[model samples]
Target: EEDKIIEAEAQKLKEKFKEKSLTDKMKDLLIRSIYVEMLGHDGGFAHIHAINMTQKKNILSKRIGYLASTLFLDKDNELLILLVATLQRDLESESYLEVLSSLQAISRLANSQIMTATYDQVHKLLSHSSDFVRKKAVTVIHRFWQINPNGVVDIDRIMKTALCDKVPSVMAASLNYFIEVCRQKPETYKDLTSSFVVILKQIIEHKLPREYDYHRMPAPWIQMKLMEILALLGEEDEETSNQIYEVIQMTLKRAEDLAINIGHALVYQCIKTILAIYPNEALLENISKSIKAFFSSESNNLKYIGVTALNAMLKIDLKYAEDHQENVVECLECSDDTLKLKTLDLLY
Candidate 1:
């Protein structure tokens, strides 16, 4: 009877240990593993996972999940590598879904620590039968661009392969990454970006566009950058890019009413670059006339920009606006646009 009681007590203790929640397990793991490897105190998260498994519970489903969950979230670099290892080798789709609460935990982690292993894992995720994994993998890869400095990233290769991904999300993300890089300062990655755009223009075989692609493929970055790059280039380069940019801008500008929810700043950048490049006489003969018409019909923000660009032009070559003052006055009188326009009129 004494032996029987002792065995029962041991069994009860085992069960109790198994039932401890994920947080308690994290305390054990961090204290043991991560602390030693990273923090120098201890070094083994196996126990945390051990406890978590014994409990048959989802770490993400519990409150302390945030602590464990963020290990794979955006900022935690080391944890991201660990999570991608699991994503590729440890967890299956159905099990991962039940075990993890937020998708961001896995996706953002991958976005933060992309490497050969992570890249392969992302390809696997894209190839997964699950649409969710494929979609998330695509978005995660695109988000990867935001964290990568140019020296570290193989952007050309990524842009190359991503343009042809079987999945829409992957393709879109890759294109967007390229586009975002276009907005960056030239001194940082000018040659690479310019070559990429120029290559895109010549190889009509892999043709991209200036206008927006509402379909699964949107290449606004490539589209605008291609035009802007060409505009900044010498005569031959400008000829190709300028033709595309001018037409696209004209169409897009017409479509965007004054009350848009976004995109004013990006378009403004395009306009600024063009005004800065055009010669005073050429600007007067070419841009000034249409610019006046555009401002006359535009909303407040457009008017403000028009005035600013005009002033800058006048500053650079007094003859630009001075030569076209009659057209400017006509647009000003008919401006009937906004208070900003009226203010611009008085100021000018």
Candidate 2:
């Protein structure tokens, strides 16, 4: 009886939700009940709520639209059909916020038909001259590719354009997608290695938003991702390989005498890159020494990175790597399960 009463009240609120006369606060209440409060939701009422609120002209309405689209939008094509029209309108609207919400909805929903239909709109926004929109578009494209790689045409061109985009964030997103593409279709992207190396080098040497420091290093995320990409590029090309080694050496030199997780991570990435691109006794010695320094780090994250780096060297130069046996055994006493696993890997 109580459940029936609650259901009846929820239905009444859903009816009130459809009224244009309903205030934002009232609609927000309805949305919170279904999306936040976890009220028993009728699919029909939820669809009505989504459509009615999404068509309204306010941020609250759009917020509700996003919430409905993500939480309660039905799997059937019927509700999505209504949403696709609204999303298209939002995409074409002059308001970037509307476009942003639409993209967010599309990304979360992962409906292949919606992505295919909105491809042109997303492609246009990729060059929309707004860094915010472009970055979102880059992410949406990546999501699209993840959902249905075949649906995205001219993907290489899209990635190349994003990589060269003037905005650093755009380039970062582009590199993320591009790296995946390289992993999937290595042969197709080999020709672009040299160009990507140059881009990665530029980003490493002097990328902006330089104030966003991680472990006292500016933008370590970008630096690490760039280093990973460089390793991939250097796998075949001698020129690229030599350039990668030089960058790794330079990064290692800079990271020397540093004491931060990000700096250790940078060194970690550098050592990993060197192993991938140009593994040699001399380089392994440097990496082994660096990993030794990292083992002494108080931070578990740095210590784990140290263990991982040492393990990579163990596969190549077991003679030199054997020197770290005591340190690796000591890591077995660490609390972190991941570090323990890495230590076991090193030992076995």
Candidate 3:
């Protein structure tokens, strides 16, 4: 019955498209039909309309077309290769929005064939004039790398430049890409540690533009990302750990001064980073205080993170977590069953 309704809908859409021009209403209905087709209906009815929409001069039509194509076409679909030329043209469009839309589609729809065909165009956008375009380009390149790492030429240079991108959004996307690279081959990218450290210092000093600030905190997401990457790079490397120690201390102190919600999150990430790098006695004392402070919060989320961090701390040194026995017991009385379970684990 559902399939019958979908086929009826598709037939109505096909009749509507017979007119020389599309009204906005008709365009919307078409997009809806493509969406339904995407839901495993296998009607195979929307592909031609979707492709024609991509060739339309109207930006809205192009956007809907790209979106529909991304949703309805599988990576292995033969039709996907047909969009390579269209995507390349849009990637070079004078309008940044067009470029952004194409990049977004490629990011989602890219396969080995699509990545190889459009790799150069996407790479050029990494240095596009608009920060918005640059940010999206960085993300697309990351996706392409995942599909075919060798397709991205000079990645080391590309990443180094991206990490230092003056725009915070671009830098943030680059950090995400770098994180993936570092995770898989830490030694190859370990030398980039100082570069991340420099960025962290700049953020800590409030050098980022006011636009990146959240609740008066300077780029907390970036801060968190830097901490994450640092944690990854510094793990099991004593020299890297020592190099990052001062900034880690500064970050902890800075997070402590922010508003409660954001502060708790930063502190939680900091605790994880600390554990990864093997915190010293001083840092352990700070983590102990931070975890206990979390337990005092009325928010269950804070309590859960606190409990988890404490469990981790216990692994490093029983002495720091010993005083938190009362805090753990208090958590058992809370209404949150998940938090209770985590606390129970800690207690066990």
Candidate 4:
């Protein structure tokens, strides 16, 4: 009912924008109203409003540009070409802010044509002298690769250079990109095994600066990505398996002092890596103990992770399902829907 009312008002405001007598203040307010209620809105008036708002020389106008482009524009929209043109013009500017904003807007609203047209500029920004520009550039590349992997030219070279970057933010962004690419083409990164494992070990062992911390803890996202990549690379090779096993053991040991949610994610990914690569009785027992410890944690997140890990373990060996039956059954009484669902899965 409220959305319908907002839509009605938005329609009225659209008609008001057509009036030549409308003041700039009234126009701004109308844009804000439409911006707030952009959801479920499919009117063409927003395209003109966003374009007008974007042309104004102010921060508010720039923000409106971002919001409007993200909310109102899609690949098939006729207005996308205008948005792309504006972004390209901004990118060509010498101002860092302009380039950054353009980079951000493109990341959010880029279509195949936008990606293809702006590819070289973003690629050059990876090596930009400013860390801020480089970081944003790496992120844009990552987003672009995700949407169209083949759209990114020289990705192997890009990944290799990004991973070797001195900045933590740059490295993290590159790792994220690498994780995605490796998911689709795991064998393409086999050559980086030794270097990748070394970096993962350093990160897991807390050897990096605080910049790497996700939430005041070691970077769990990077750690989990590395574990996944390791699982792929080490699956059938005894030497690689040993290397990953040691890293997993260290990660589990470090989980004791970490934040509950972070610890749970780490343990969950660690268990998955172990199961994927080398699931010996000893490794399984180690994961079993980790999950049991998570169950004992006061944090529900940990408990959910525990249940999830146990559910996965049960698939590998039904004996685990039997061993942890009592504990798993207790989870059914929890109020958390996800935990309840996983517990029910375990029970059945």
Question: What TM-score, computed on C-alpha atoms, does each candidate reach?
Answer: 0.47, 0.81, 0.90, 0.86
lDDT tens string, model 4, 242-301? 766776778777765575677767878889888777566788889888888878777677
The C-alpha stretches of model 1 lying farther than 4 A from their native spots are 1-103, 106-117, 126-139, 142-155, 165-169, 180-273, 276-290, 293-299, 311-318, 323-348
Q: Whole-model lDDT, candidate 2?
A: 0.74
* Collision pairs in model 1: 32-42, 32-43, 32-44, 33-43, 33-44, 35-42, 36-42, 179-221
Model 3 misplacement above 4 A: 1-20, 34-44
Two-way TM-score contest, 2 vs 3, winner = 3
Tens digit of per-residue lDDT, candidate 2, span 1-348: 867776777767666656675564655655655643355545456555666577778976786767776777644546677777788888898988888888888877756788877988988899886788898898888888887878887777888888778777888788788678666665676677667666655655656666545555656787788778777766656665765666677677766746665666678788888888755466667888888888887777777878878877767777866677777777899888998987887778
> Best TM-score goes to which candidate?
3
Collision count for each candidate, in order: 8, 0, 0, 0
Q: In candidate 4, what residue range of length 10 has the lowest lDDT sum? A: 21-30
The Cα local distance difference test for each model comes to 0.45, 0.74, 0.83, 0.75
Candidates by TM-score, descending order: 3, 4, 2, 1
What would the per-residue lDDT of candidate 1 be over residues 1-348, giving only the tens digit for each residue? 654554454444345445656454554443333223333222222334432332334444332333343441345444444444344443343554532322344444545344444555544454556545555655555655455544335555656565565544445455555556545543343444445444434332224342334332234344445445434442224433434444434423432332232344434444554554433244334446544644664465556566666775565566665554654565466545664465465455
Give the 10-residue window scoring lowest on summed lDDT in candidate 2: 35-44
